[model samples]
Target: MYSMRMFLLFCVLCLMSSTGYSQLPGPPGPKGDPVNDGQHGAAGQLGPAGSPGRPRIPGLSGPAGPPGSAIFCGRGVSGQELETLKNSLAKLELVVNYDFVRRVGQKYFVSYKKRESFSRAVEFCSQRGLELALPQNEEENNILSQFFGDVYKTAWINVNTNKAEGNFEADMKNRPLTFTKWGEGQPDKSIQYTGCTMLSENAFWRVTQECFLNAYIICQM
Candidate 1:
C-alpha cells in the first residue's frame, strides 16, 4: 500500500511539471516587431471581424441618370379646333364701324347698305373713293349668296340694264349709279316696261321695286 501511494504521487508531480510549470515563451517576437501589438502578430487577433469590414461602401454614387427623353404628339386639326380658327377669321373686323361683314373663305366679306338707288349707290362708292361693288372671287359670290338667302331675294351685281333704254352697260359707261347682290334666276324680262333690279335671298331681285330704293353696298378699295 505505501509503494502504490508513492508511485501515484510521483505521477501527479510529473503531470503538474509538464502542464502547469512549462510556460511557452511567446513566439520569438519577430526580430524588431512586437507580438502583442500587431507588428509581427499572431497575438494581436483579427479583431472580431471589425464591424463587418466597414460595409465596403461604394465610392461616390455614379453621375445622375440622363434627362428623361421627350415624347412626340400629333399635327392635324379637327372639330372645334377647325371651327375656332374659321370663326376667328370670319368674325374679325379691322374697322368695327363697318357693318356688312362675313368670311369669304380667305377673304373678309362685306356688302353695301340698304335703301339707295343704283345711281346713288355708285355715286356714294365713288365719293368715298371706292368701287361700288367688287367680288374678290367665286367664294365671295357664294358667301354673299348666303346673305341674300337669309333675306329671300336676288342681289344686284353692281351691274344693270340702265343704258340706251333697255340696254346694259358698264358703271363708268352705261352702268347704273348703284347695284344689287342679285341671286340666281333674276331680272326676268317678264316685267315688260319695269326693266329694273333689286336684291333678295330666294331671288328677291325680280320684285322690281322703284330704282330710288335706299340700300347699302360694298366699297372696293
Candidate 2:
C-alpha cells in the first residue's frame, strides 16, 4: 500500500510541474522610464470673420452768424425820389451853363472881342460850349446888327453856301434862311461873293469870297 501511494503522489507532482499553477504575485518590477512627452501639435486654421460694427452718428451744426450790415442790406430808393434827384441835377446843370454875356428876346449871345476867320470863329464858339450866332429872323438880325454897329464894323454870321454855291443854309439849323437883308445886288454869284456871309456896320448882309477874312465872333446859346 505504501508503494502505491508514492507512485500516485509522484504522478500529481509531475502534472503540476507541466501545467502552470496559480501563485501569489511578486512585487512590481521597476517602472520603465516615463514615456517621452508627445510632440507639440500643428497650429489650428484661422476662425471665421466676425460681423461688422454699427455706423457712427454725425455731429450737430454750429449756431448761425450775426446779421449783415445795413449799408449792404438797406432798401432801394423810391422811384419818385430818384426822379426828383434827376430833376434837381438837370436844373443844376442849366444854372451852371447859363453863362451868357448878352441877351435878346429868348436868345442868349456871347460876343468875343477878338477877330477871327469864319471857321476859327466857329471853332472858338464850339470850344466855349456855344454855337456860332445864327440870326433866325429880322428881329434877331437887327439885334445883332445894332450890337455890331456899336463895336465891330463886320462879323461872321453862321450862314454858308458850303453845300451849294448859290444856296445858303444856316450852319447849325441846316436849312434855308427864314429871313434875309442882303445888300443891293448881293450874293452876286461872282467869285468874290461865293464864300461866306458877313454883317456890315450898316447891318447889311454881304457875301465875300474871303472866308478866311478875320472878323468879330458872336456865339449864341
Candidate 3:
C-alpha cells in the first residue's frame, strides 16, 4: 500500500511538469542528405496569341518608302538615261515616237507626229518627264516651226497667255517671251480664254486656237 502511494505521487509530479510549466525547444537535428533536383518540366505550349492591343501613342510611323523611278518634270534625266530612252523609243513601232528626238543647242526636243489636244500633249510629255517645247528666241522659234515641215499647218507650243493679253510664258522654262514670231496682228484675243500657240506652215507662230484643238506635240527636255 505504501509503494502504491509513492507511485501515485511520482505520476502527479510528471503531469504537473508537462501541463503547468513551459518547456524549452530541443536543439536542431543534423541536416539530412540533399535530394536530387526534380527533372525540368517540358516547356508549355506557347500561349495563344494575345488579342491585339490598342495602339498607345501610335507606334512611330516607319520611314517613307523610296520614290518610284518614274521620271517627272523637275530635274531632267541623265544623258545615259536619255540615250536609253532614245534607244527604247527607236525600237518601239510608235509613229513619230520619241525616236524623233532632236537636240538643238543645250535643249532636247521630242516631236510626236500624232496630233493631240494641247492639254493631252502636255500630259503625254509630262508623264515622260518632258515639257511642251518653248521657243527661247527667234532662232529657236524658226527651228521648231521648220522641224514639223508642212505635215501640220499648225502645231502646239508651250505658250500660255491667259492673265495678260501679251503676257506669254513658256511652260518648262517659265520665262517671258523675249522674242516672238506673231504673224501680223496675231493672238486674236476675241476668240479664246487661254491662248494656245501654233507653229504655222510659214514658220511663224500665232495664238490661233483654244486648248481643245488637236495639234502636233513638241516636248522639250
Per-prediction TM-score, please? Answer: 0.38, 0.51, 0.51
The C-alpha stretches of model 3 lying farther than 4 A from their native spots are 1-97, 149-151, 169-174
lDDT of 2 by residue, 78-182 (tens): 667667667656544543554335566666666746689888988897886667887777777777776654545888888864636335644545666777888
Taking the tens digit of each residue's C-alpha lDDT, what string does model 3 give over 1-221? 99999999899889879797646676899999999999999988888998999977868889999966546377768768878878656534332456466666776677756688888887887876667887777667766766665556677888774636444544434666666677777766475456777878787777754668878887776
Candidate 1 CA-lDDT value = 0.52
lDDT of every model, 2 decimals: 0.52, 0.72, 0.71
Worst 10 residues of 1 by lDDT: 163-172
Which segments of model 2 are wrong by more than 4 Å?
1-100, 149-151, 163-166, 192-194
Q: List model 1 lDDT by residue over 75-184, tens digit each.
A: 56666776776666544533254667665445554554454666776776677434555454555555655655343344444554443443332343453434344345
Candidate 2 colliding pairs: none
